[model samples]
Target: MPHNLTKQPRRRHPQRSQYGLTLVELLVGIAIGLLLIVGATSLFLSNLDASRRLLLEARLNQNLRSAAELITRDLRRASYWDQAVPKMGSVDNNPHQGITLDGTSDISYQFDAPAGAASAAGFALTDDYRIRMTIGQTTQDLTDPAVAKVISFNIIESKNKIDIGMQKIPAATPNTECLTERRYDITIEAEAPSDANVKRRLETAVRVRNDRVGNCS
Candidate 1:
C-alpha cells in the first residue's frame, strides 16, 4: 500500500470568472453622467436669471413709490398761512395759495415758511426724463437717473365747494359764505434704466388741508 501512493494524481480547482464592464457599457455610463451635470447646470442658471429679474423689478417699484411720496408730501403743504385764522374771510389774503400746473409735466406752488415768509417751490420733468425739484434757489434731483428713467408725470386738479347760507357777518350783516376745497391727482410712471421691461406706475391723491373761504358774491 505504501508503494502505490508514489504516483497519485493531484486534483485541480476551476478558475473563478472575473466580472467587469465592457467598452460599450463604460461609454454609456459616462454619457449618462454628462447629461445629469448639464441638466443641473441649466437649472441653476435659470434660477439665477429669475432672481435677478425680480430684484430689478423690486428696485423699480421702490424708486417710483419714493418719488410719489416726495411729491405728495410737498404738495400737501401748499397754501399754508400762519395768519389764516384771522384772514379766513378774504380770498386774496393767503399769499401761499398759488398752485399752478404747466401743461402736464410741471407743477408749482407756494408755501409759508417757518418764519412767516413765502417760499416758492416746483417739480418738473427734465428733457432727459428725470424728476427735478426746485425749492427757492436750490435745485435737486428727486430720482436717480442712473437707476430709473421717468416716463411720465401727470397731474389733474379738481375742486369742491360747500355753501353755508346766511351766515352772520362780523359787521352784523348777514352774508353767504362758501368754502372751496382743492385736490390733486398725481400719476408717475417709471422704468429701470438697465432694463426697460421692468417698470412701475404709481397714482396718488393729495388734498389741500387749508380751505379757502369767501362770500359767495
Candidate 2:
C-alpha cells in the first residue's frame, strides 16, 4: 500500500492594524494648546497691571493728605502768643497776630518761639510744583515731587466783628471796642506725578485762637 502524502496549506492569521492620528488632527491639537497658553499669559499680565495702578493711586492719596494736614496744622498756629506775657489792658496788641500773603502762593506769619521771641514761618509753592515749608532760615519740601505734584495752593482770609462789652476806660468814653475774629480757608489741589488722572483736593477752615481788638474797620 503506497501512502500518498497530501500537504495542506498553512492557515494565515490576519495582523491587527495599528491606530494613529491623522495630520489634520495633530495640527488642531497643537493649535488648541497654543491658544490656552496665550490666554493664560494675557490674563496674568492684565491683573498685574491693575494691581500696579491701584498701588500708585493709594500712594498718591496718602501724599496729598499728608501735605494738606501739614498746611492746616501750621496755619492754626499763626497768631499764637505766650501766655506768660503781661496783659496790656484788654486789647491784644501782639505784633505777631497777622498773616501775610505774597498775593500768589507764598504765605508768611510770625509766632512766639519757646524763648519768648518771635519766629517767622511760611509755606510756599515753588516753580517746580512742590510745596516748600520755611521755618526761620530753614526750608524743606513738604510734598515729594516723585510722589505727587501740587497743582494749586490758596489761602483766603475773612474777618468778623464781635462786641467786647465795656471798654477798658469806661470813664473816658462810653464807646464799646470791637474785636476782629480772623479766619482762613485753605485749599490744596494735587495730582500723581506718574498719572495725571489720579488727583485730590482738600479744603479746611481754621480760626485763630487769639483775638485782635482794634477799630474793626
Candidate 2 Cα errors over 4 Å, as ranges: 1-20, 83-85, 90-92, 166-176
Alpha-carbon shift of residue 17 in model 1 (angstroms):
7.3
Steric collisions counted per model: 0, 0
Instruction: State each model's C-alpha RMSD to the native.
Output: 3.9, 4.3
Model number with the top lDDT? 1
Displacement of the residue 158 alpha carbon in candidate 2, Å? 2.7
lDDT (0 to 1) per candidate? 0.83, 0.80
Q: What would the per-residue lDDT of candidate 2 be over residues 114-161, giving only the tens digit for each residue?
A: 887888999999989898999889998988899888899887888898
Q: Which candidate is the best by TM-score?
A: 1
Error of 1 at 140 (Å): 1.8
